[model samples]
Target: MGKYIVIQGQNIYDVALHIYGAVEGVTDLLVNNESVSFDTDLKAGDELIYSDDYQINKEVTAYYKMHGITPASGEQHVYPKVFSLPKTVEIYTSAKEVGVEFSVSGNGKIELDWGDNSEVQTITLSDKITVFSHLFDSTIGNKRHVSMYMQGHINQLDISGLRPIELYILKSIPIERFVLNNATLSIDSLPMLETAFGVSLDGLKTNDLTPLLELKNLMSLSLTQTIYRQPTIDAYLIGLVRQHDNRRNCKVVMTARPSGEYREPTRDSNSHYRITSGMEAVWVLTHEPAWNEGGIWEFIINETTYKYEQNH
Candidate 1:
């Protein structure tokens, strides 16, 4: 069949005129290149077939071959398209749950490999926002390698899950928050908690402040409404606040109340004595000014010059 390579600003009609000297040849052109839309503008590298009896000119065929253009077989390969995932996917290995929210831009199927040597999970994607969850067994290692395949390309991520204390020698999981208010926190789990940006020990029952002291990156510690009422626990937690404040050079806000319906500890003279004694008796307490309105107080350590600020 005769073939013509469509160049810039050229259409089927133009190709017909150039090849057969008549616009009526466009019908033959369309019949041969049925894959092309009649109204669509021809791309610069489009190959238009004209007649089955007429052979493509040797020069034009060589030109197409040199440019790596192959004759279209009338079948087009369409791949699935995907949009960028909205947020970082966080999967809690301890809970064995995947929490992800994203949108698919094109038609395709998504395959998720949870890196546990298990069967791959697949889901169909419609052109809309999708929020889905997947539950699987906890991954074995410190770092979980999950692969997502869409179309023919693959996107992978090293999903960090809850790591055991034995894996502490390895890289720490990039966890931003650790919330175990009423749950029993083992000393071994302290290493995993070391990298948390925020740790909430609101209702912690353990008196072992040693584990919490290791969390040097803590930004906020909530002790306001918890079951911690022991004098020693209070003292140790105050010490933890001091150590965290001095080491991180970040103010640690400890929320407490003098009296409330909650059965938690009341910040009394005993708590004050523990705080002072824990700070080598060099700590000074200062209450916020009356204009502050809120009954806020500050405990300053003279040695490290760390302030344990408290807000009512």
Candidate 2:
């Protein structure tokens, strides 16, 4: 004969008393998905189905473990989640060092891991919110990983007073990837030997990409859903290619739309196309703005050259 525990169709009260050592309310725990109380009883081979809440708890635990992050007191921020910014403000996560700024005031969050066992801080300001800043003073060469969440909104951002190499030093890494969605970016830097690369503006009306001159490590740039007229596109693309050729030997990829339903590619599309010493090659793609179907432009860089003509 096998030992069997019986539920007997009693409410949680009766079952808890019999199976657990004088412990009642075990059934309520099962229904509510609370941690099993110490007194709850169960006989051999007794089984209880898990409630929905149990699954949610398990997922949350898994997320924390994978991302190595936790929530702060009085705040609701989770790791591996994207954040956006509301306004432009200077921050000093590291003393006396300038940080990036956003043009439009809106909600933006950052994936942050402060040095010296500091908990990750995630913040999202409202539309009226502006000037998102942080402080960092990790020992020089101590690298940290920070990410921004832009999601699907169209906005503009700029990183001022930092060269491409300085950026790498700040992050403690060489290869950096930035994501932009329906947004425009303006980087301000003087001519330097180092190279940097990132996505171009989707709807940029500006003629010069001189703001991006010092980014020698630039590899991929996406320009999917911008509202540039044909002439603006031609001028911008030509000028960009020329600039890259003149500075660091880096290859650049320009993307655009050919028709409402067709996509195309343009490589070294400048009038006086000259390959840079570091540039392996240049590629341009013309496609419908992904935003048309609710998608942002994607810039996938396989090179990091910034070649543009002095006059486009």
Tell me the whole-model lDDT of each prediction, alpha carbons only: 0.43, 0.34
Q: With candidate 2 superimposed using the best TM-score fit, by how many Å does residue 85's alpha carbon deviate from the native? A: 20
Q: Give a tens-digit lDDT track for model 2, residues 90-204.
A: 2223323434333323344434433222344554434542444444422222223343323222222333222112222222112233332343333232122133244444434
- The candidate 2 region of ten consecutive residues with least summed lDDT is 161-170
Clash totals, every prediction:
0, 58
Query: Model 1, stretches more than 4 Å misplaced?
Result: 1-171, 241-246, 249-312
The pairs that clash in candidate 1 are none
The superposed Cα distance between candidate 1 and the true structure at residue 150, in angstroms, equals 22
- lDDT top scorer: 1
**TM-scores of the candidates in the order shown:** 0.32, 0.27
After superposition, candidate 2 runs with Cα above 4 Å error: 1-175, 184-208, 244-312
